[model samples]
Target: MTSKKSPVGGHIPVAGGMATKGLKYAAEIGAEAVQVFVSNPRGWAQAAGKPAEDAAMRESGVPTFVHAPYLVNFGSPTPETLERSVASVRHSLQRGAAIGALGVVVHTGSAVTQPFDDAMRQVREHVLPLLDELPNDAPDILLEPMAGQGAMLCATVDQLGPFFEHLENHPKLGVCLDTCHAFCAGHDLAAPDGVQKTLDLLVETVGPGRLKLVHANDSKDPCGSFKDRHENIGAGQIGEKPFAELFRHPEVAGVPFIIETPGRSADPHRKDVETLKRLRDNA
Candidate 1:
């Protein structure tokens, strides 16, 4: 059982269908942390959180985090879409606070026809005010970079530097580094020294303090493939060795690693969680 203890409390299921059962399922498996979506991931509708369930989860002593809806694209070409995205982000931030979540994760979407500088400007203009309005206890807004595919932005860790600069060190702004996405963005984390180099670059570019969470999904594609396929922990293109390095990295010792891997019917929660735990313990 001691060997089963997860480093950052392991991976969590972000499905809303398992919302009520999420805490109980997580507690039974000895998870020290968890992440959930406040509503349907494929839609924009925000679901009302249950106080009783939230309290139960809090009492379980498991740290919780909320993931924003998947439909939110801050870089939408349409003004209406951008407006809705802003509203949805603000709502998720507020909802995350209500449920005692540490933070809410949102994808760093593309700017479409707009220049990257304009995208950064829009984020600063529309998102910074929301962060400023958050109370001290409000959950932080974590930006997750996507694979370097299409117009989708935030492909690299260094690319996010100017965007963070525009926010001017907002307390509520942080990062959620996804392993698969990082690999897809051209940062090699598979070789013996790969994970260390990538981690060093991350700490240098984003500051370790701003790294609030991680999505520990192994990719189904090769390095710099620009694909978003996520396989089970060790059964992917990125083998399991690099994760040992990731788990032992002091900068990310206590950050939550949410499983954004595929699968709904036959959820691989236990396997993935145990895989991370084993890596941490072995290290």
Candidate 2:
């Protein structure tokens, strides 16, 4: 296994504070990367990012990414919801640029009885062109695949190929593979061989260049369960061995592993990050 030199990266629920304090906290935690919500996750109200604060974060040399609001669903059957999702994505990209973030993460959504093909088409027709207009500095749109439980299009790594085909493989499009979702969608990431095989298939389908981010979460549910429950590192069904395999994978060698696991108190975040760092170092 290939051992890593710099295993320290990002962690989640960045905590409520002044924008600069968020950066300070990440630095204090020894994180070289960070993720933040540009707006309230549960709301449609978009918060404006301060230019000075954004510049401060950018100058910190930490690779940053924005997690889009949870309520914005591009695949919503309703026209209002669809419009909002596109607008939300556009706003997110703008916000990301303000903070010099590399990308913005948005969930691959369900079509709610509407054909997924049609929803993908909406993404292409209504969303892709806006991306086309943006400059190179515009943060890439990182689509996160959900567990295969509903009308979601990119349910698993295997199912995500059609999205590239549908989008004609837009340059700005990339992926954020969530380990918990991948496990729930039937990829056995807990096993060393299974993690390698799953990542190999992912690289084959999306190409390593487009695999930009990872939500390094462990799942509470069994593989192929299609449930979205997450657990702390080494405390879930996934254990620690597969994460060693994951951190060792050349495809994700320098990628940021953001923790979306449960953060009841400081200890869980501390434990999860420490466990991941150890796994990466011992890989």
Q: Can you give the lDDT of residue 109 in candidate 2?
A: 83
Tens-place lDDT digits, model 1, residues 1-283: 2223343544345344334577656755556678877777788777776777666655665677888888888667678878888878888887777667888889988888988777777878788888899998889989889889988778788877776888887878899889999988898889878887877877788786788888889999999999999888888988888888887777777667776666553347667777787777787
Q: Which ranges in model 1 have alpha carbons more than 4 Å from their true place? A: 1-19, 28-30, 265-267
Model number with the top lDDT? 2
Q: Give the alpha carbon lDDT tens digit for every residue of 162-272 in model 2.
A: 777777788888899899999999898876589889889988998877878888888899999999999988888888888878877888877788887787555667677
Best by TM-score: 2
- What lDDT score is found at residue 24 in candidate 1? 58
Give the local distance difference test score of model 1: 0.77
Taking all chains together, the TM-score of candidate 1 against the true structure is: 0.91
Computed on alpha carbons, the lDDT of every model, listed in order, comes to 0.77, 0.79
Clashes of each: 0, 0
Whole-model lDDT, model 2: 0.79
